[model samples]
Target: MKARIHITLKNGVLDPQGKAVAHALESLGYAGINDVRQGKYIEIDLAKNDADTTRETVERMCRDLLANTVIENFTVEVG
Candidate 1:
């Protein structure tokens, strides 16, 4: 099975990197931009073939190490 993970900051959290990118875009003449948020994407290959088990394992991975549970949220997709 393969697992894909997306890790992003929760709402109300300040994102300095995202802010910097937005400012850079605006400075470069990009207009009408309101906001920008940055996140992480990760892919993993697993030995297990079961989708349910793979998802559970990946979710655990996110909670334990992949994401900061207090300030970040993660989503998992398995195939």
Candidate 2:
């Protein structure tokens, strides 16, 4: 089985890194860019084959360490 996790800042959160990237893009002459948000993507290989169990395990991983639940939201995909 495989799990993919996408961790991102919640709405209304400050994103300094994303802001820097947006500024850089503007400096490079890119136009019409409204906003930019940066995030983390993680892929894990698992021995468990059950999709339900795998998703639960990955969600636990996110809650425990992978994501900051107070400011970040994470979605898990298992296959």
RMSD in order of candidates? 0.6, 0.5
Model 1 root-mean-square deviation: 0.6
Off-target runs (Cα >4 Å) in candidate 1 are: none
Model 1: per-residue Cα lDDT over 3-79, one tens digit each: 99999999999999999999999999999989999999999999998999999999999998999999999999998
78 in model 1: Cα distance from truth in Å? 0.6
Local error of candidate 2 at 29, Å? Answer: 0.6
* Candidate 2 C-alpha lDDT tens digits along 1-79: 9999999999999999999999999999999999999999999999998999999999999999999999999999888
User: Which residue pairs clash within candidate 1?
Assistant: none
Candidate lDDT values, in order? 0.96, 0.97
Worst 10 residues of 2 by lDDT: 70-79
Q: Name the lDDT value of residue 71 in candidate 2.
A: 98
Which is the leading candidate under lDDT? 2
